[model samples]
Target: MSYRELIFTVPAEIAEPLGDALLELGALSVTVEDAAAGGYDENPLYGEPGLSPEVQAWDRSAVTALFNPEIDHSGEANFIPELLASLKESDFHLAQPSEKIVEEQDWVRLTQSQFAPIQIGKRIWVVPSWHEKPTDPNAICLAVDPGLAFGTGSHPTTHLCLLWLEQNGDLENKSLLDYGCGSGILAIAAAKLGCNPVVGTDIDPQAMVAARSNAEINHTLIQFILPNEDAPELAADTKYDIVMANILANPLQVLAPALVNKMRVGGRIVLSGVLARQADEVIATYSQWLKLSVWQESEGWVCLHGELLSAISNEQSNPSHIESIATPQKKRLKLVLLSLFFLVLLVFAEHLSRNSLLPTLATRIDGTSSPIAVSAFSLLQKTDEILCRSLRCINRSVSDFTAWKINSASLAQESSGEPLKIPANQSKLQVEIQNRLAIPVLFPYLELTLTDAEESEIKTIQFSPQEWLPISWQDSHPLFLLRGAPSGESIHSELAFVMPQNTAGYRVRIFYSH
Candidate 1:
């Protein structure tokens, strides 16, 4: 089947009336675009949320209407002239009307051909209903088809987000909240990865329906609901372990506070649907409550990942100090005196028992620490274990450790066509680091590994501050002398790897020892 497409360049004032006039004159479909597209006078029209209806169309509009080729006007033996006469009589004049023959094709097959099984990271695959599941038996296949919703894993923004989730492991037992969950792909992926109690919210009722259907097909338990303006609650009195929002930059900025309030302390967030240039703006918006940075980039799109920071995390890291401040003055003094007396008694007992009871008492004190303190101490203790397991280094005491925190960290591949040329045997890896702590500490050493989609380590590289650094401080100090970076500082560093073939992603483990 074929059709005739009638195109007209009309002023914005009459575009709507002209479109209605065309439709009343027996047009199949009408579409509009900017007449000055690709020219200096081009006007870009954006339909942002809360935008007025007047701003939806361009100043100079090009309207195209489709019609069946079989339509005839044999009264005068000419169809174009007769149609023009009719439109002019109806007070809708198209000065110059253009006609073109539009060939028709199998739109269903064509649309289906445009989509295939998209592989995200190693374990996750977004497969359309018509497509076969990936051959990998262990793959977490999501049965999603194109619908009225937005995401289908073909867009670079969604791809970047899926890759982030796959590379960041151990989501088991975590809770997730997916805002603007078009098609609910991210929320379902989290559920498949072992995150329980997953919830997806969207403003569109159709999107909520589609997400629910998709979740049912995937056999993942996900709760899909419309955004409740009155009570926007996830779990009552509970914060989410992971929150994902793959929305545009403006909405992301507007929802920053709401999203932050839903996240537990130290919980992770993944944001996409942002351009590489807009990544900084988005990060700055979320920087107040969440430390966000670009985690990955595909083509020109960027994915930002961050963790929630609050007074709870700070208190958890230093329970004893917090307890001192929170406790009454008299109780604090009594505790100090009791601690001193216990120290004296332990010293005497150690002298008498010849160190037999010293180890037991130390173990008891360590075990009696608060859960947050214990977790922090365990992470600190793992420094020696990590070094011993992978790279060899001297074990140091935790007391020497500075309070420097990893407010934002990102691991991404260098863009192609970088000015710096890499050797034939090496590949480029870029690391973005931000310090959110009040005081700066020495440059922390990092251990980076290039891994394939399957997460198998292909190559391991240990980096210190002395290595090839991109940003330099005015008063740079030696690596051994723990450099002091002022609060809210960022650094970028690049390193060349031994060019591991088939490398899909990277895993970075930072080892900070002062």
Candidate 2:
């Protein structure tokens, strides 16, 4: 869980290059924020937002990259000194180990300790902080506490999907597949909505543990599996009526073809986790196989729902279908040779007619438009051989034969809509959470609590098919000590100890690391 954060200031011209070099050096994640901006002529760290109090007019861009020790250390540190030495008046300092860690306890204390009940699909309650009874008029509730899983429902993307399902009405008896099931919230929701044979798959095993626990809590049946398992065969055998993949754009695009195969001919596929800007490319990837339709848009994100088009079959007639099996076509060399000879003659004649015989206006204009001119031509030139060698890291697989070609012409027009503006930081922080244990973690790992805030209470709440945990954080930590309630509630909300705020210097503990 301990990560080294490389924080430095660099000239704008070299910012991008240095960032890329660092990533190639072994950074796990790189983030660029518009810190204090000032003039480059002011100070060495010009363009950097804040000054060090000692110097007032420092203006430089601060670029920070976080690298995981699990990845590579020697590689990252190898050329650092050389790279920094090249810059004129370059100033760099490494932060102490304690300064880099964002104390989890401090975060826990800042968040107000409370859990609120969230209702999903008429019968599931994603209760986190405390256990509560489900009293909704027409819904069954299952309670669950999902920690570090993706399906918290607070994210606009997840909420949009749940809203879509809710409005779609009962999914009774419809087979469902939750692709990239993070915390297995969608699959569980499908089951609670009356869907049968609910199945979930993820690239992470932690998600499976959470999903299985969630299923048991819900008192419903759901099959969870890893992506590269016998599950594909099972899925093909029992085609699902609904297939939902809420993963990000790149992976979604790569998995589009395989995901399409999991659905019945006319089954519905719901794709979320796509930013508005990236929506078009994602849609185009699967447009040929399915009649992709815009189903819902919320919070600068979109959920595309597509119906499998019957026209897309294993036939050659479909214009969009590209067969993996190659078929060779023989060409008549004699005809090609004859065409090339004639083409050269026409080009030469056209050039002479335009340049030499163009004295008369009428004759020149008429001759300029050649009827037999070749539309396009290219020189078939050869290049010298270059020595090449390949090395494989991590997966150690040989060079893949698969070829990828980008078809720009077919790409949907990029949206010119304005970027959604997120609310500015507020003095008072409020976090509402709903969790189901059965899913994997994605980006934006929960920063559980903030420094100097009262710990959020964990309580059992009612949900469709079962009850789970809901965590809510509010208020400051120094005031209230938190611990599991002695009430022996089905689930304990709030911790039993209070952490003293580290005001002198920052200290962070990896309370939980996946």
Q: On a 0 to 100 scale, what is the lDDT of residue 431 in model 2?
A: 20
Least accurate stretch of 10 residues (summed lDDT) in model 2? 404-413
Superposition TM-score, candidate 1 onto the true structure: 0.57
Which stretches in model 1 have alpha-carbon errors above 4 Å? 35-44, 51-53, 71-77, 229-236, 311-514
lDDT score, candidate 2, position 92: 28
> Model 2, 1-514: lDDT tens per residue?
4665655543344556656766765666666443333421122322212312332222234567776555655235544444344332243222111114332245443442444677654545566645567667666565556465678676767876776777777588988888888888778777878888888998888888887888787778899998678756354556778888888877888889888888887789999988787788888999768767678788788998988856345666565544432331223566688789987775445344532221121111112222322122111000000101122212111111111110100001123211111122211111222221111111111222222111222222222111112233213222112221111112222221222232111111111223
Quick one: best lDDT, which candidate? 1
Best by TM-score: 1
- Candidate 2 lDDT at 374 equals 15
Candidates in order, TM-scores: namely 0.57, 0.45
> Which residue pairs show collisions in model 1?
442-482, 442-483
**What local lDDT score does residue 297 receive in model 2, on the 0 to 100 scale?**
82
